[model samples]
Target: MLKLFILLSKSKFGHPTVMFRLISRLMASNKPVLANTPVPVNKSKKRPAWSMYPKLHDKVLEKLKENQLNHTFNPKDEEHSALKTYDTNIMGRFRCYNDECSSPGWGSKVVAITIREFSGNRYNARVYHQRCRECEKVGRLIINKSSYVDRVTYRIKKWNGVNMERPKWEEYSGPPHDRKLCEGCRLGRCKKGKSDDE
Candidate 1:
């Protein structure tokens, strides 16, 4: 049988098939086929700490921690009661405004904060800011007033410092501004225009 196998392996017509069979048999014998090869073990690839918006990521974390501490201290404050908390883990998706480009919208996280008595205002006013994963590469920041919630409140005192009325919350009736488009779209547009001119 060994002579016959060697003859078949040596024959030009059956050489490939016989060699394949022999390799398969050798591999099935429970010994490592690549015994001479050095295999790397326990080598893990490290992911980056931040994919985009490193400064924004740190700022958001700090703000969240501060808000949590402040909430604990002023649990009963009416202003605190009106504060709205957004899910920081939830990412926002926005499409590129350039119609010619096939690039899909980027993902981002919206951070909204309302500071009470801001700049001597009677009520709490909210500001909206966004940290986009794609736009951050080009150093573009997304800021707009469209997402603001204009809640106005005032205090009234009467007669010997007696608090006649607490701060009243009123909803803003004005129409919201249009949402800002992606800055990447502008860059795409400029490139397209230059190509056309060329």
Candidate 2:
């Protein structure tokens, strides 16, 4: 048997058939030979049971549908320019109605208004008021009307106690002329012509 093993090893039978024959012969001899090479055992970790598919709730599905409908109806509405400056909590800048204020106006960074319609053409709308930063410094106060829809006829009260119906402007009216800035320029927090350097 040793002579046969030595003869098989010396022969250059590199084909798979020769290897299979050698393995068959070894099995037939009834004497098992231990291989020096270690057999690789897979040590992969098992996934947790909680990682299975999740169950969806009816309310969640309804909410997702509503959101999809809203987005499909008016995609631009979600991309309102005001969102760039203010979030829900922070106030942003707007153009001052007072052309001579020489300072930037004050407004909410994000303006979210909701209008509800009822029977008989009656409607309820949410309005937001933004005061001019420069005007506030003086005794006078200027408040601008902001609405969800365009050209809304809303009542506004002036400093002189005069009530007037004004039309709301578009969400974006070109670029705001009175943009808030540092305390140096005419449109900043500082007084006109007075900077921190002086």
Candidate 3:
């Protein structure tokens, strides 16, 4: 009986033997190489960039179409405005035209929009100024004339009188001290040493 079993094992019909016992053991431990089965895998679908600014483009167009007035909140509709609060954690609202807005700094108004065509990683929404038509046209013209330096400079300006006057200089220096100070630090850069304020 032992001789018969040895003869059957020695035959080449069952499966081919290979070198490296560990490799052969690993291969043998898996399922047979039948034609039907394959290993399974899972892949998560990525979210689109435009998904973040959902309906923004449409909202702007709709507002424009209706010719909505700027700077005033309408009980009936959504209009363009600067973002005063963009954070999810804070319990506050952000008007896009608010002075603290990081983009397209236009003016301080709750219902006024101060953004146009802002881009994200995968998408962009056209932010717009919510001023009247005349201001909007002039704003665009200035944007066109401005150099890169000036364009960036333009986004920053006085917002809700936060830095209306330097605390120390407000009383002594008086109003309209220097256009340079206003132009250079439209977003409050005059207080050079007070790094802690930011």
Pick the TM-score winner: 2
TM-score of each: 0.19, 0.21, 0.17
lDDT of every model, 2 decimals? 0.30, 0.31, 0.24
Residue-level lDDT of model 3, residues 1-198, one tens digit each, is 233234434543222221122234435667453323232222323311111223333443333334331222222222233243111000111122211122343331111112222212111221222221221111211121112112111222222222323222112222222312121123332222122246
* Candidate closer to the true structure by TM-score (higher is better), 1 or 3: 1
Candidate 2 residue-wise lDDT, 26-118, digit = tens? 668687555532212224333111110012122222333342311111112222332112111112245544423455444443332222223
Stretch of 10 with least lDDT, candidate 3: 85-94
Candidate 1, residues 99-139: lDDT per residue as tens digits? 22334444343322333321121222332233233332222
RMSD of 1: 20.0
Better of 1 and 3 by lDDT: 1
Candidate 1 lDDT (Cα, 0 to 1): 0.30
Q: Would you give me the overall lDDT of model 3?
A: 0.24
Stretches off by above 4 angstroms in model 1 are: 1-103, 106-110, 118-121, 124-128, 135-198
Error of 3 at 198 (Å): 27
